[model samples]
Target: MSTNARQQLQHHLRNARYEVLPLRGTLEQVQGLPPGTTVTVTSSPSKGTEATLDLAARLRGSGMHVVPHLAARLVRDSAHLDELLSRIEALGLTEVFVIAGDADNPAGRFTDALSLLRGMEEIGNRPHRVGITGYPEPHSFISDQMTIQATDEKARYADYIVSQICYDPNTIASWVKTMRARGVTLPVYIGAPGSIDPSKLLRISMKIGLGQSMRFLRKQHGVVGKLLTRYTPENLFDELSPYLVNPDYNIAGCHLFTFNEIAKTRQWAMETADRLQEVPA
Candidate 1:
């Protein structure tokens, strides 16, 4: 954030948010980021619920717009959720992103995102903003029909939908249209990975247990099987640049999956913004 180029680049970003990894070291890194920056914390109870909450409080203290991922499955019950929300509200937090967290087994009775959202509502912890996940492609765990159903339910309770990291803009555009046509009106935030090294990218991808993407990569058998062929979602954004500049698509803003590569991702996004401004819209 100290670079002059980055300070200038931020002016063009009317709406953009950073998704930070919830690990210990990475958490400290994001803490040092510029204030008022909206930072979304990944919610993985498997990663530990206490850590997410602690980080959120810490970020809020830094005057940044801190958003904690409230993994619904981890909440013990309405009482437990109320306590959590009370803590956040105490810190002046106004936003939260809810997800069907990766916990295979429930730490409590709440098992899905809807259950969690409902619990939050019942406990009078309605946040100023709430976000739900949307999958442009078929879900790795559930059928397409089920994914759509889950999305619809989430939409009913969420303020917006942040689509999963997809590498195809056409796929995302089609999915957005389909979602709107189906009456799921939550504005969409198309997610893409920020800048990252190819080797480290694949290593981190594997570390995150990217089941669907790995399946896709493996199926690309004989087609550049090297790890370099892993994935970098910037290509998807390049294709979607047209839609991004269009207002009718209900495209909200950028949601970068940093993969804990904050500095590199910020650099890449600013450079792209600079390049885009140079070209005719």
Candidate 2:
């Protein structure tokens, strides 16, 4: 590996953010993370937005920088949005990730992230930094053209973009180049799975619209076999290393979808950083 690639990988591993789901043991798992670590909390249709905000507040109290997900379909209306905003302000959080959510039915007026972002703007107490999701592969429901156009519109309000977890580095790199070509200047955070079980990863990935990427993985002989034991983003990092230091990619490190496997993921990250540092320039 080139020296600059190694250094860039090390830098990303050291500063990567963790994405955790709201569950029974999630808080305890996150508490073990190093102080000042940035943790993004996910909002789901089942848990609702309240669960995300509550956990975010607690995580903030624990000295971690928390970015809560504000799912558009979960919010009832302007009043609910105001309440959530009030709690976030009270917690002094300045960052949030917005998603359209996987809810089957609309909760209220806000049906998508763009609308919720506009609502936040109208409400007048928006977080300083807002993040929106990007899809490198085709969404399970939405078409590729629609996803790209939606991202372009949301870019006006978002500070950054966290791509959906993708298994292929070439697809991701191409997506970044496409976005840049289209004049979307937002810094891109490549999303990849952390150290996680293959079974669980597949189930979750299929659940969240990563079908195309999953198909790609299946086509690669022995990839599934290796993942059957354990899955890590090592290959992903190595494959994307060339773009990490390239200015055109505008890569802003990584967003690890830990799937609440915090300890394993953190250990892998630390070890990887050490291994990269030991490499000769």
TM-score of each predicted structure versus truth = 0.85, 0.96
Tens digits of per-residue lDDT, candidate 1, 55-156, equal 788878788898888888788878888888888788788999998788888879889898888887777778899999888888766788998988888788
**For every candidate, C-alpha RMSD to the true structure in Å:** 4.8, 1.4
Put down candidate 2 lDDT per residue, 95-115, tens digits, no spaces.
Answer: 999999989987999999999
- Summed over model 2, clashes come to 0
Q: In candidate 2, which residue pairs get closer than 3 Å at backbone N, Cα or C atoms, i.e. clash? A: none
Model 2 CA deviation exceeding 4 Å by range: 222-230
Superposed Cα deviation of residue 230, candidate 1 (Å): 9.1
Model 1: residue 270 alpha-carbon error in angstroms: 1.3
How does residue 278 of candidate 1 score in lDDT? 65
